[model samples]
Target: MHAIIQSLCSLWQSSWQGMVMGELKYRKGSGGSGPYRVSASGRRIVRVSAVSPSGERMDLMLFPAAGFAVGGRKAEGGVYWHTFSADEVRQYSASVGDHNEIHQTESPIVSGFQIAEAMEGLEGKQDFRIRFHYPVRSGEAVSLRSEGKTVSGMTDVLCFVWEAL
Candidate 1:
């Protein structure tokens, strides 16, 4: 039983798939696992959509569970990178009226950042990292190095951790 249990645990952890597209992606939970179960009423929903300059849309959903902590585990803040495709970014600049060449394709790249109100001194002013689980279309992978003063001296900060596949 011990050998069987250990084997199952190993297989469970090792089974996690890295980010892939145009492939049959498994719908998973906050922690990806399988023999994935579903709710009876199908009341749960997760919506994926584009803000302005629409591109790809992917959605997976599950029922909520206990303990809704605003911030995720720090140890799980793993490898991070993001790139904004020039295509989806076009209509975005038009929407924002930031037609400055500095924000457009001629600049090669643009970046963005945010800090959670929960992450203030109450949570300790700290830096976070990111990995491009999906292709970043706009305002991405930006740190204080790129944007400066992520969460310092703010009334309320809104941070978004996109998602990890």
Candidate 2:
């Protein structure tokens, strides 16, 4: 995921411009495993595509962070709370090879991929769309809840919604 984001940034000739929205879709019978070849195109709205050796394809749409609203809808259903320690955040960043400065700060921001991984029952979904309203800092408490095909992560400093399609 870090490599994919870097590819997109390089294509755009920018540095951590941030994203407004993103979507991921997995092909049928394609377990969405890694070792993917990633590429990106477009300017205002970048379209990132990744293909795995096993023919699994993932398409991600990233909207630029400009003139976009930032807010989150309330999540419904059972809720679970989690707090990521600074060490945990650092470990995740190291594991993913994403040494972005923002994520290495004293109060590190949790990576979007980490947040996605924290959501339960997201596996086996054919498609899902996610919008990150704000950055979740390490040590900040986060609440997760799922209603049907939708899952949401809310924190005091950040919130995001993921809907399976």
lDDT of each: 0.26, 0.60
Clashes of each: 3, 0
24-140 per-residue lDDT for model 2 (tens digits): 444433445556577877777877776655555546665655554356445344455788888888787676665555567788777665665554244443445566766677887
- TM-score per candidate, chains pooled: 0.22, 0.66
1-165: candidate 1 lDDT, tens digit per residue: 112112222321111222111111111112333332221122332211111111112122221222322343222232333335565455444443333342355432221211211222233433232221222224444222123322221112212332223
Off by more than 4 A, model 1: 1-77, 111-165
CA-RMSD of model 1 = 17.6
- Looking at candidate 2, the ten consecutive residues that score lowest on lDDT are 4-13
